[model samples]
Target: MTVSELGLLNILPILILVVWACVLLLLDVFVFPKREQVTPLLSAVGLVVALIYTIPQFGQPKEAFNGMLVIDGFAVFLNVLVLISGLVAVALSYDYLNRMGMARGEYYVMMLFSISGIMLMTSAADLIVVFLALELLSIPLYILAAFGRPKMESEEAGIKYFLLGAFAGGFVLYGIALVYGATGQTGLTGIVEAASGGLENPVFLLVGAALILVGLGFKVAAVPFHMWTPDVYEGAPTSVTAFMAVGAKVGGFAALLRVFMIAFPSISVDITPVLWGLTAATLIVGNVLAVAQRNIKRLLAYSSISHAGFILMAFVTYGDASVRPEATAAVLFYMVAFAITSFGSWAVVIALEHAEDRGLELEDYAGLGRKRPALALAMAIFMFSFTGVPPTMGFAGKLYIFRAVIQGEYYGLAVLGVIVSVISAYYYLRVVVVMYMREGDPETHSEGWLNLTTAVTAVGTVVLFIFSAPLFDWAAQAVLRMF
Candidate 1:
């Protein structure tokens, strides 16, 4: 391999982040106090610079690290998404950490490190690389979840997440081992060649793939594996929760799609039922349970699980040759929609959250419309978008996903998706109703950074819908280059 391909430039954005995070860590200790606001500002700057580097790489796919890392339009799309989310996360974290008495440079550093891991996962072409990326992202998050020391709930979240993540990591590693034994390769391209040519140990391949699904399902918070989500999301600092909701899912889905679409396409027929079952269960359980949640964080947690189900419809249709492009495009677009909406909603949550996690109950949202009309209006738009209503990006994303499902002739799944969406509308709209119709003083931190983040996301959540056609076209072009 050429030195150029093996060196840092081979993964320029990740390399930039590594240095930036380290610098921030060092500076945090020497030059700043625990609650210094400069840390997040610097962190955001670094993330933006990294994004600028990533932006120019669009449409040009290449391989590095002896082809173990593949940078294509798809990877570019996901990396940019994660990086941009990192910027927003930084924006959300500054005031939140202060109010919670946990502001520190290390928090931002951990987040930056986690984002680098997410970016790495997007470009990973080898199972080993993906596993490493998974660990790289997860460890920092584990620390961040517990950053609010002395908070028993935060401690519990940290411990539970660590234990579950370790278990999931073990599964991914063992699955990689089994897949290697079955195909005599760990690289996606090599695995494809082995599987497509008719592996002698197809049973091993099947079992390995199943194990991988279990492992990734945990990260994406699919049903059964999603038991960790509600508790962790509720206990962790809301800022950390906001970041994980989007960043972790993006990374998980990136690896899942890269592995399944590239290495296991031939086996998709055997695996379709499993995928279908996962998506179906996730949607029903997520939406059903969310309705019972009084804690807003837990409600959104389950809501996230349901969104995962909605996005997975794209992969269900992946096996259809005629619809593959549209299916892939739909998944990509859905992720973008989910990231923006989820992040924005969480910003509102953080604004309302007080020390010791007060004011987090659904009822606490009452009278928000009277006290803070702008915030209430933004929350309403997010609620409507989450319901997949028109004039928002969520609708466009759901439209693409449903169209893909219908085109693939999975009418039952499409119907289930629609029905569950109707069920979801009840709870999502309930928050809005409480905000406008009910009466009580709901306090907010009123942090400028948090408000800015919420406003931008709310605007993007709506405005993007009008320009969604271009996004779809870009997604189509990107998906075409995936092969």
Candidate 2:
């Protein structure tokens, strides 16, 4: 009952990252004032340290900070994933920022801060903590989106993201208040316990959950709330777009999985239909709209939205107690698959991007196969993975998700996923076709870290699938403690 009893070490990974970000912020101002390169390296080092701290705590399930946070397999899995994402972002940002004349130490600092928020979100056990974590995760992203100062597009992206993000935050906060009003509890476990005993205002609870879903749907770029995504992705710096694509979705889904599965299962019957509609609409809209885009970033933005729909397919079974663990595991695995494939694709996009944002059109990618065969091959692999082709992690991820959906008896959703995935191939392969089948000189940067990121992620996307069973088992283990 006392503050002294609140375990702190249980969340050491999050703490280390938060403290490191603060220290790095100061170091950026004084020690590395002129060295843009040093900050990213240091940022990567901090993320590695946090990852090390995280990996050791995977099996030790416990609550901390007065039950506001938890350390468990799920938390550890996401913590490690988020940390790795931060490191990859650092690598991608190292040279690109300097090339575009937007190199600033604060860029890395903001990323570190945002990543720490993601780490916190994965472990949050209370609604209050989830709201705090959501804000911490989002605020830095708004600033980072605008990091390319004076550029009209970047400025517009930042402001639009900021305004919309704040509106989404309002939805979450109001939902939290309503949930609290209905159950008089903010802790997820307590909310479930209170609801199971019979909520006096179950309607309030249902509406609140819907509002929270709306807010998170925005974060994951689900349809009806996804208007901000394409503009932001196209306008923001490529490195920021790459990181934001993965990090924000992970954080949003983490909260969504935890809160809905833990706190709202008692009312799943009322909410299951909503999840189904979101999944179908998001999948259909994301892929259908993407076919009309010529800009690569916008296409990938829609790709991100469609992938979110695929993840939502697994989440559609959140109400099925018998299939919940399997669904959770499928979602975790698919996130890893999506992250690897996404980063690799974006790396190729970044390689081809120029100072004034040339090389971004679909036509700009023509002849990339002849000019940069390796990068082109990597892009092809990424595109294939996105299309759910074999030997790639995306295929494995979609397989797991469809199987889980089938197990949950959501055959229609699974079938829709397949058809849309086929639709997605049209645009995904268009890039590859342009690269190999057409003819236009494509200029690309051959930065060491950038190339390494593309190569490693491209390799990981394939290699991990070959060993997907163990990886999936690990993901399964992560949610064993949840229920």
Candidate 3:
């Protein structure tokens, strides 16, 4: 494409974000000049503006910059979701950061930068773009994770996440190099064409694919690659943890689905078995391990891992062109639902934490219902929804995925998912039980402004189920255009 064409197609979104980030950085450094003065308000407004700017491109498929990036329904859908989640995270972070005494404009800037990476990731069709976006998303997160600089736990979480994340990035880059060598191409379209032409040397291609999967596996926190999750979730600031859980998962899954479904579809036979094994192991290990955790954050981290397994079930059944639409829609809807519910859960934890100590333990939640009825009610909704109870979006998400798996004749995986959902309920409901059944500590009091987040989350959780049909339809339409 000519420079003018590329500028028209690719540069809009990229330029919008670049300009936005630069402005925010300038305001933070020169105008605000103090951490306390830099509010998350600017970040929120910028994201909203970005979302509005990107919304008009939803139905058009525009590829630019030598076809390295494609803006289509799928990319637009994921980008909108990421932006919404980022906005919510920033809103929740304002109070949470101030309460924890970690309020800084850099925090919001880093979040926006990570969000920019997520938006780029979903649109990336070239290996170089994918690697660049991944780093962009990850580097900001590393600093955000460690933004609680003076706190030992925060520093530890940041260091551990950075070390592991860099290692995973290496694996991903190596895999890309191998794939490039095998196929003599670095774009998804090129790789797909090369694979279809019959492999002159399948060794490098297969190994590259495996390494890529490993790298992404760590990002999504699939089993065996999930050890860093619990500690990181427990130690990092709750807002960052929430963002990591929801925003990171959405971006990771977006890139993963694009790479696997479009670029490497022919390798289903090899990839399917591996994913099946990972799914089974993740479900078993995540739920089983969660049963042993008294720390609510850690429990939720494991829960998130198990949920990843559930999402993978959709991919396992994604081969038939007829079922692909439903499968993809199920995964997308599930990600959205999980994001809302998980954020609500963490917002409560962050809000309730005492100034002297982060209050994430199950014991700390005791008598929460008695002390703060509104917060307790919100937590109850999140817990119940997470457990796949009726009338919540989580149940609807699980039901759709399970139904899709069965329709594709994956009866065993479907049954396994159902069984694990039951097992997950025990731990999820434990928090609810403690809130309602226990007595309150005489000294404990509810934190302020957390109610705003809870209220928003609760409404989202309920409305998601009520409006799930339209959301599913939108996702289905987006998936149909993916081909």
Which candidate comes out best when scored by lDDT?
A: 2
lDDT of 3 by residue, 1-483 (tens): 567667454537655765787788878877875645454887788888888878888786888787888888888888888888988898788887877788888898899889999998989899889889999999999999998889998899999999999999999999999999899999999999999998888888888988988998889999889999998887788889999998778878888888888888777778888888888888889998999999888998999998888888887865565777788889988998899999898888777776645476798888888887888898999988998997899988998898788888888898889888889999999989999998866234344456777899998999889998899898878877888
TM-score of each: 0.98, 0.99, 0.97
Q: For residues 1-483, what per-residue lDDT tens digits would candidate 2 score against the true structure?
A: 664478777777778888988998888788865758788888888899888878889886988987889887998898888888888889998889988999888899899999989988999999999999999999999999999889999999999999999999999999999999999999999998999898788899999999999998988889989999999999999999999999999999999999999999988998999999999999999999999999999999999999999999999999999999999999999999999999899999999999888989999999999999999999999999999999999999999999899999998998899899889999999998999999888889999999999999999999998999999999999999988
Q: Rank the candidates by lDDT, best first.
A: 2, 1, 3
Error of 3 at 83 (Å): 0.4
The collision pairs in model 2 are none
Tell me each candidate's RMSD, in Å, in order: 1.2, 1.1, 1.6
lDDT of 1 at 305: 97
The per-model lDDT (C-alpha) reads 0.92, 0.93, 0.85
Better of 1 and 2 by lDDT: 2
Regarding lDDT, does 1 or 3 come out ahead?
1
Better of 1 and 2 by TM-score: 2
Q: How far is candidate 2 from the true structure (C-alpha RMSD, Å)?
A: 1.1
- How far off is residue 29 in model 1, in Å? 2.0
Better of 2 and 3 by lDDT: 2
